[model samples]
Target: MAFQTTKQTISQPLLDTAASLYCSASPHPTLKSISDQLKSQGHLDITPLKVRRLLITAGVYKSELASQIQSLYDSGKTITEIMGIMHLSRTSVHSYLPYVINADDEETEEENLCQRPISLEQQKRCEQAMEQFQKDWKGESLWEVITAFAGCTFVTSKGLKFTYEVKQNRHGEPTNELVISRKEKTVTKATVIKAYEKLLELSAEDSEDGITADQAKESVPPRFPIPLSGPKKLGTFGASYLYPIFIKLGLITEYPMLSYFHLPFSDDIV
Candidate 1:
């Protein structure tokens, strides 16, 4: 299939409509149009640094980061390579795990799948980006993007009640944001108390949907420490060989070593 990408023009009508479309609610022609125009005009007045910020924010605020990341992946850059370009850290990298892993309950299948560990400087960039994100994303949730967060599971979304996480680049850094959504529940202008009520409702729903709902469980993720029902056995091979590995190989899972207690699945990690 032949493809043609048509960039938006610096049209006044589009500018007028952008506030409803863009989150910042800025009145100017959005970063998207600005980028489109710069790419169209190739003017130095729009500094490369500014253009890059526009690009990153467009990917973020406009909710296009995932597709941009996928494009990088399609080009064969390792996850680490992508991380450097995006400035994401270990948390951000793992957040993307849900999107990249295609196998069923198979963590091993995805093993050695990450590109490379980010360098110290690159990691610093990620940290800085995250700090900025914390400042800006304090009260807002993620922008809804296409093919973005494709693998990210929807935590919950019910008007005023909303929660989601986003992993993307911002100002040349990779970062993750844990977003708690807020919207007026309805025609009713939600007061602080009303908002709090909605939050409680959302919380209950999340507890039910999150860890409690076995049916809603994710297929593959890193294993956390599991709890055992009783005392563990310690011997020559150490904890490594003592507990049996029962979870499937494809996905990360914690096997119950004891009937009803809490412990790390890798009781073997000495």
Candidate 2:
């Protein structure tokens, strides 16, 4: 197909050509190859970067960083918020954003007000992104998981609840916030963390002597540890979800697990 371009944008035929070359090619044509092909078809200004830009705009590009940015955006994060959470520059975030969000755009405003629920596919991507972030995270921010699960509400086995949402700060920029509640009373994130630590402490005391193989086989499976009476009371949510995350991020130690011992069968005898 003949490729054409205008001063501001490449023609649909040209964009479609780039998409096809990159998506349908057996060995996967490189941007250079696509550029050459387009140039041969009378579009001489085509360069590798332009070809890449076209593919990116067409949503056919498979860039890890770009996908990460798009995923964050899909999760209701603003450009500035994405930059802060990802440590990326504004230009970098904008270049990879899958959708446009013009300031005066009526649709954008309406969408923001509506705050569409995160779809399953988007949720899966967000979860994967959060996992990756956790792996690469340093001691930078508290409640970093909020980045991926914004606009989500999670409930614990008990009545405690956790909500991850974004709100405008004093500077009129979007920022992540975590809210915890139980029995209609607000709880602080610090309070939750401390309570979890205390529970771990208590659990550790319960297992301080450690369990032998015989004891482990006879003992019933242990559920999450929770403090019965204390100023810092971690409900079911803190014990199950928050505890594991704390262990993973290295913010707290993992509770010990009893090792199982199996007996040899009769076939093992000589």
- Each model's Cα RMSD: 24.1, 17.0
Q: Model 2, 1-270: lDDT tens per residue?
A: 001111243366777888988888665677778888889999998776667666787878766666666786775554544554455555545545433224432112111211346676656655565566445432223344434545544433343445534445799775533433333333345544454445444554556567553443233332232223322234533354454334222333322322222211111101
Best-matching candidate per lDDT: 2
The TM-scores of all predictions, comma-separated, are: 0.18, 0.30
Candidate 1 accuracy as TM-score: 0.18
**What is the alpha-carbon lDDT of model 2 when measured against the actual structure?**
0.48
lDDT at 256, model 2: 30
* Top of the candidates by TM-score: 2
lDDT of 1 by residue, 114-232 (tens): 12343455445444543443343211211112112222222111212122233345675434332322331211112212322222333334353454323222212212222222112
Give stretches of model 2 more than 4 Å off: 1-10, 39-50, 57-59, 87-91, 99-270
How high is the CA lDDT of each candidate model?
0.30, 0.48
Clashes of each: 21, 0
Candidate 1, residue 23: how far the Cα is off, in Å: 18
